[model samples]
Target: MTIKWEALLQVFGATLLVTVLVVTLFVIGIRALSDEKKGPAYASFAGCVAVVLYGLSLIVF
Candidate 1:
């Protein structure tokens, strides 16, 4: 059987991008909370949760 190298690379790139995005959002949320900014902190956290839920949905459905 032949491996599809292009498809494998695409999946790897997408996974890497999502991981970075989630980490960045979490860091921003923490920093905002420490700086006494509640609004942005919550928003960032919500974004992270939304991404997680979306990923779960993709897996389930």
Candidate 2:
């Protein structure tokens, strides 16, 4: 069965999926880091934020 809003929902679904994946990866990454290696992880986090913003813009506009 197909719904009329499938196209809109596709964008929403992708955003939700990526959000979960990123959070899971970030949690694993943070846990795996040693005390001294956090700098790079934080940098990676900032990169993630950029990606999220871009995806958000796509879904929003």
lDDT value, candidate 2, whole model: 0.76
Question: Compared with the true structure, what per-residue lDDT tens digits does model 1 show for residues 1-61?
Answer: 9999999999999999999999999999999999999999999999999999999999999
Show the colliding residue pairs in model 1: none
lDDT of 1 at 56: 97
Residue 38 of model 2, lDDT score = 77
- Evaluate model 1: give its TM-score: 0.97
Candidate 1 — what's its lDDT?
0.99
How much is the lDDT of residue 32 in candidate 2? Answer: 45
Question: Each model's C-alpha lDDT?
Answer: 0.99, 0.76
